[model samples]
Target: MILEAAMLHVKEGMEGEFEAAFRKASHIISSMKGYIDHECHKCIEAEGKYLLLVKWETLEDHTVGFRQSQKYQEWKRLLHHFYDPFPTVEHFKKVAKG
Candidate 1:
């Protein structure tokens, strides 16, 4: 499986808006092929910071398939404006698990 993580830096007062938009956007990604699951967590120590975690069957499913799909356009439209500097997404493969 592929694990994708993004550290989102939301605008000062737009954190709530970002969370709401992400909830709606999550539905779109969850319906795609090869999607395993996802979760969003907020940082208690840092305001306006969030973590987006997603699991996929393969990297291509996330990088190519999802990015190339029309759903991504909608995803961007819904959530892109909330970011301040924009999140940098990175994907990794499991090495060891307990």
Candidate 2:
């Protein structure tokens, strides 16, 4: 499995709206091909910061399958504007697990 991680910094005063939009946007991503699961967590210490983690069957499942689909356009429209600097997403493979 491939793990996709993104550190999201939402714009100030838009946290509530962003979370609502993300709740809607989650459906868009989870319905895509090769999607396993995902989690969106809010930071306790930092306001408007979030941690997004998604699991995929393969790298291309996200980089190509999701990103290239029309769903992505909707996803972008829904959630992308919430970011200030824009989140940088990266994928990783597990090396060890407990």
Candidate 3:
């Protein structure tokens, strides 16, 4: 599995709206090819900060399959505007698990 992680820093005062938009956007991603699951986590110490984690069967499942699809345009339309500096997404492969 490939783990995609992004540290989303939402625009100030738009946190609520961002979360709501994300809720709607989730469906778009969940329906994509190779999608396994995802999670959005709010930060405790910082406001307007979120951690987005998505599991995919392979790297291309996200970088190409999803990002290249029309659904990605909808995903971007729904949630891209909420970011400040724009999050950087990275992928990882499991090394060790408890």
Q: Which residue pairs clash within candidate 2? A: none
The residue ranges of model 1 lying beyond 4 angstroms of the native Cα positions read none
Q: In model 3, where do residues sit more than 4 Å from their true spots?
A: none
Higher-scoring candidate on TM-score, 2 or 3: 3
User: What would the TM-scores of all predictions be?
Assistant: 0.97, 0.98, 0.99
| lDDT string, candidate 2, 1-98, tens digits | 99999999999999999999999999999999999999999999999999999999999999999999999999999999999889999999999999
Residue pairs with colliding backbones in model 3 are none
lDDT of candidate 3 over 1-98, digit per residue (tens): 99999999999999999999999999999999999999999999999999999999999999999999999999999999999999999999999999
Please report how far candidate 3 places residue 6 from its true position, in Å.
0.1
Cα miss at 31, model 2 (Å)? 0.5
- By TM-score, rank the candidates, best first: 3, 2, 1
Ranking by lDDT: 3, 2, 1
Identify the superior model by lDDT, candidate 1 or candidate 2: 2
Q: How close is candidate 3 to the true structure, as a TM-score?
A: 0.99
lDDT of 1 at 58: 96
Global lDDT scores for all candidate models: 0.94, 0.97, 0.97
